[model samples]
Target chain A: MIKENIAFKNLFVTVGTTKFSKLIDTITKKEVLDILQSLGITFVQLQTGKDFPGPKLDPNVEQLCSIRSESGSYTVELEKKITLKYNEYFEDFNNEIEKSDLVISHAGAGTCLEVLHKKKPLLVVINEDLMDNHQMELAEELENQGYLYHCTCNTLVQALKQDFSALKHYSKPEKFVFSRFLDKCIGLSDGK
Target chain B: MLRLLQGLNFKNYTPRYYFIASSDTTSLSKIKELEQSVEKHKQGEYHICKIPRSRVVNQSYITSIFTTLYAILYSIPLVFKIVPDLILCNGPGTCIPVCGLGFLLKTLFIKDVKIVFVESFCRTRTLSLSGKILLYLADVFVVQWMCLKDRIQRADYIGQLM
Candidate 1:
């Protein structure tokens, strides 16, 4: 049971640099909608990369797709439950991530790492339809390590409803390892 | 890598980042993210070069030729102006040309730039096309997975960079 006044409100959805229509489509399902509403999520910022065709909203749901002056900023109101922002490139994307309580994204390494860096509650939905099925390995590894939660088209709603306390136990990636690697590269370059 | 570079103390060496912008829309957002992250740190200088997207698999001959030509042409100015002590690149089709340029500079132009190639984390089983090409040119090649290390003689397994 989701508390009506829980701190988790803002939900940011991103599909990395490729199109994942299936993910967008799955999230708009009626079951997922009910779960989100139960959890009191009001706003959803969807960074649908150039390829995702808009979600298929139910006929009864009132949706207003508006074009604002901003290049990739648009709003879609779904059944008076969630306000969806179909935004392109904006400075606010990271700001939105910082502000978000939970981030739902396709399993792109950059997006996943950014979300983890912010230490937000992340739910990754793997898009198997990708050209190489590239994201599956990383998503599975992270999920197995209890760093982040992952789901497929069939299991997203269940994964969403569960408590994500494991997020707190997940350690932030160490910066020193990469710095050492860079130091080594620099050393090699300078011949020292 | 950008974040790591940004956070460095830089007591001895000044690092410059050079990126080849991808034509894809998602790449645009990534570039924006990188720019913002770097700006937030307020450290280091970087350059972005735009080149034609190179498709390795199932691409027409003409397209491949055009991509190769454009990449080489775009890299010409970069070769001369942005000669760094080391060139660090990850496995991607775009990096092939850049690494090739670095190799050319090292052998012909007598530039002392060392190339470090990090295989993409996505490759758990097989070497990517970019990784395969870079194996011969790169001075130091690192792989995230042990499997890749076993397969490639020169690659060193340095655990994953998460």
Candidate 2:
């Protein structure tokens, strides 16, 4: 049973660059939109332009006064400013990440790590043109860790509309092992 | 010595770029075709030597020797003469050799020469086995997008190669 007071059922996602990465489906924006719609979520989008900050913010939070001006293409600045703005728009954004049942983020492993740290149930989309499919590799690792759901935009929406707990259960052990592996690989064992 | 290497198709030509590579003499023979095809075309100066077949061990795995040998044999002497500040490496296969030579010349002779790796792959992240080695050797690792910069620890994320 889904709840009613939801302020952000659909997420308008953003990315940092407009380059040739296949991770974000440089060719598949409409596919992403269709999936989001199928998930019973509204499609709020923020494709990056060459502006300093990158794209537009979530429409609801625009009322806040503490919002600072971001730099780089409009879309870039929006992504950079999101965390801080979320802090200011706490209730609205919190409900958004929590009640919406899913948050789809286009950030790479670093940003995905942050989303995982927040314990949000997320769908991570990886672009293809990355070095060794590092983003997908990381997504595989994170999916193993049980941190979030990882897929191309199309797969993600399909997975989200169904029972996510099944996917979540399978991803847990992998995420755990991956976290340990990362700790060892990065030599952060002492948590330093 | 601003030499370019390729089949020299009129489609790939830009103003004043040199043609240095071709798959075979059929392509080599077509250099004249390229010359006459474009309105702004200039005559071919010299033909690039074909890289003989050989085995190469890429960073991730073993590859044909031709990839490493040809790039090195053909590009090194050019680097010594032209001393390009930047080598827009289309991939590890081609750019690695130019960069290796660039590093050697800069360390042993000329100083402050820069090599920029032009990332052309459309999907996947993390440096290719050759790219992994080239990253340490290159002066600037330019990615097509900043998103790539996240996965790559040290690249400059210059937002596109072309």
Candidate 3:
């Protein structure tokens, strides 16, 4: 148990904002921001595209830590000067992914699993209202495999308040493997 | 030598078939419940039962579409067995229109059936007209392949059926 003894800092949280899905509304964004604030984590959110506007962290969260809600949206908050750029590049994005010690992601299980394969700790927040309940299953599987933390918005917020370090330490030792699926997809099989 | 060849033939030719059962919106809850039932059975529980749902396909009054949907849905289960231990479904959109009746009947009459659904369509990519219709009624709609590791939802791909 990595107790919060030392000054716990340098934490990053990423939220997905791809206008591909309209699920990331004001309430969901605020919920994610609130959790990061409670955990005393430094955070950065990723906007998948340049469709909808990006939002600033809750005022309270902004005051407590160095939080930047990065997005490709055109909107801005007057209080914080976080810049909005129109570049859709992965160079900077991938770099940011590598830098973060912990990542909070949406329940697009494939994307999250790809991130998890990077060997960083992940706390996958699933949107409960998905028509298919796909996100819920993804997060739960990662959680079961001992590699990620899974929760709804409210439960995640409570968890952050308790201790972020404990959650980070809870990551399991098992490696996530995707070879079998790849084998099938690419048409390679031992002819038995 | 003959006995060895027979043993080898059996080992090499054992067929591995994966059935991807499609379910619709209405069947989602029952499928989830059955998943839990399977888990309990695995944990040494006795007489695990599936949650049952009735078949009802909505129809536009234009013609006999509902009747056709009912006939197709009902006949599937009769042709198929509920005994497969690994049943994968794909929907969240439209598998139910054609398969929900089968799922319902199996749950009502069968014992020890474990069915899972894989949501396999990404709506962002425009599908063919028929594909669009099926996607909407799928029991599980899947986007990424690896995301299938999730349980109760049966998102994991247990390999494509032979």
TM-scores for every predicted model: 0.72, 0.35, 0.41
| DockQ of candidate 2, scored on C-alphas against the true complex (2 decimals) | 0.02
Q: What's the CA error at residue B126 for candidate 1, in Å? A: 4.2
Task: List the pairs of residues colliding in candidate 1.
Answer: none
The order by descending lDDT is: 1, 2, 3
Higher-DockQ candidate of 1 and 3: 1
The candidate that achieves the highest DockQ relative to the unseen native structure = 1
Taking the tens digit of each residue's C-alpha lDDT, what string does model 1 give over A11-105?
Answer: 88887666777777666677887677677788877777773444565444434333233444667666566776775544555787898888898
lDDT of each residue in B84-157, candidate 1, tens digit only: 67777786667777788888888886787789888887676577777888889999888877766888888887
Segments in model 2 whose C-alpha atoms lie over 4 Å from true places: A1-192, B1-74, B160-162
DockQ scores for all the models shown?
Answer: 0.34, 0.02, 0.03
List, residue by residue over A1-192, the lDDT tens digit for candidate 3: 224543423343445433332323432355655444434444344444444445434565345434233444333232342322222224344565677666666676445745665666666666665554545654665465465677766576554444333433332222212233323333445332
Off by over 4 Å in 1: A1-7, A39-43, A49-55, A59-90, A161-163, A168-170, A185-192, B9-19, B22-62, B73-84, B105-112, B124-126, B145-153, B157-162
Q: CAPRI band of model 3?
A: incorrect
User: What CA root-mean-square deviation does each model show from the true structure?
Assistant: 5.4, 18.5, 15.0
Distance from true position, residue A133, model 3, in Å? 1.8
